[model samples]
Target: MLIRYTPGRTGLAEGLRRAARAVLYLPTACRLARDPGYPWLNAGAVRWLDRHLAPAMVGFEWGAGRSTLFFAARVARLTTIEHKEKWRRRVAHLLARRGVGNVTLRFVPPSDDPGRPGLRPALWRELGYEPHKPEFAAYADVILDIAEASLDFVCIDGRARVACSLNSLPLLRPGGFLVLDNSEWEKYAPIFTAAAGWPRLDFENGVWRTTILRRPGGANG
Candidate 1:
């Protein structure tokens, strides 16, 4: 298989490493090709999730992608929200191809309130993000409406990630996890402070950094 990555997007060495790792985990690669979950996750993060993400777990993700298929297989219920029509269709096809039925995918474009949060540099430093787009801003309510202490896992990897993280926190059940991808970006530092109550476990996988925050589950009797 030929692997081509843009120069600025990633360096040759890192690309080669990922290719090698993908081959090393060929079995996982195969599984991911069908339904992505633990096998393709960062080894450390996978280990933690494997030990904790029970079959009956329920999860919600801000962005729809491979993780959508990932959680669909592991949990009893999984809800993923996406703003991009193309991406949503791709994920839907993956689910249908795998014959997996546990996941629900929704299209909630950006909100249109006053400043158009996505375009507000003060609220979000990034431009043209889902949060900034009037078409994608409505997604905030999809996540915000989830009842408190209802979700077993949450992945904030979409537009307005910091804002998404803040909204996701309340839905996590005790012992639930919230995964924040691209943790290495300095712009996301506010998430750490905002989510201070959750125990943070950071892992660097190739060029990406993923931070897993665990909601404190009170001790068992």
Candidate 2:
């Protein structure tokens, strides 16, 4: 399932290869956690990271949990933020069992009231958080509070796209990469558009859309 990059079409083959590599690299005892249903770093995002960027210095994945263990293996340090303590604990336990040592997981309670009436209470019970409280705001605040200057790579898989975008950009070093999954979602388009100024590359329709706005030597335009 190797997809080569053609002139016009984005090569999805590399991404697939990277994903396969991640799976193969996983220990036999922990292979089941890498399945597609995992909450973090879905198959598509994993493939994209493998193809476009090298392993980063500091990697941040918002709302991605144990599902990103494979990606975590590649980076020097990974910081994963989840709003629910249950998810945090679950991911922490999984990482420990897998002997994954590089990740630091944090549980940040949400700041806004869960918009839906019944949903908030249900989620709170399920996640072991207090009911009727906003959980996402705290998550956003903690990320902003981090002292680091720039990040090598960032993956936004949480709520608050605008906040994520603002917070993430400052962390990206020059030439650093930012990957936002589910960009096709209507809410994320504005953030995507706002990122238009950066030299960008995207993979859509099973192909790469490489947009090199400013090359090393000069601007593309």
Best by lDDT: 1
Q: What value of lDDT does candidate 1 attain over all alpha carbons?
A: 0.69
Backbone clashes per model, in order? 12, 12
Q: Pick the candidate with the highest TM-score.
A: 1
Q: On residues 46-75, what C-alpha lDDT tens digit does candidate 2 reach at each position?
A: 565666545646777787564467567677
Model 1 TM-score relative to the real fold = 0.72
- Cα lDDT computed for each candidate against the true fold: 0.69, 0.55
Stretches of candidate 2 exceeding 4 Å from the true structure: 1-45, 52-56, 112-135, 147-149, 204-221
> What C-alpha root-mean-square deviation, in Å, does candidate 1 show against the real structure?
6.2
